[model samples]
Target: MSGSGAIVLNETVHQPTRLRIMSMLVSVDTTDPLAYGFLQNHLELTPGNLTTHLRKLEDAQYVAITKEFHGVKPRTWVQATAAGRHAFAEYLTNLERVLGVRARP
Candidate 1:
């Protein structure tokens, strides 16, 4: 716990990889889900590595994963949930406070 009223970072969203993933997801339109492969390639993360991070976010109810078949191939899609958006926003606020910065409008 943080003492002296210091701000504490959210462990779940504070991890570097998870933070990057959340940033990308949060920046996109909620209606448009990011493809699994796209995230992996853009982030330069291995499939397993990306999966591991995504699983953690999923467990925290911060992301939604969908698997479906397109043609004969399976595709995976991910999107930030409403709860995730709110959580990320709060995380940013806490981070700004800790860094002595102001929130964005």
Candidate 2:
């Protein structure tokens, strides 16, 4: 490890894709629902790829996924939990602090 202190992120929101997902989710703050298709397109991920990331977040209790029937098709929507917002914010704070110190040198 470098001399700079290591930034430990909560495992629940640690992976890059999940981190991005969480960030996006927090940005919306449940005011607008994000469908699985929307996330898939926004992240440019295959359905399976997006599902894996979402499952991890949902398992960690950082995100909630709801499924409902839309006509004959099932639709999935995801939102960040309160814990997810807190964790993401904490990560941003630590990241900014680390960058600030590095910039000073």
Measured by lDDT, the strongest candidate is 1
- lDDT tens readout by residue for model 1, 1-105: 267887888899999999999999999998989999999999999999999999999999999999999999999999999989998998998998888897568
- Name the runs in model 2 displaced over 4 angstroms: 1-6, 101-105
lDDT of 2 at 93: 73
Candidate 2: tens digits of C-alpha lDDT, residues 2-103: 366676657667778888788789989455668989888998889998899888888878788999999999999999888777778887777776577443
For model 1, the stretches where C-alpha displacement exceeds 4 angstroms are 1-4, 103-105
Candidate 1 residue 27 Cα shift, in angstroms, is: 0.4
Local distance difference test, each candidate: 0.94, 0.81
Best by TM-score: 1
TM-score of 2: 0.81
Worst 10 residues of 2 by lDDT: 96-105
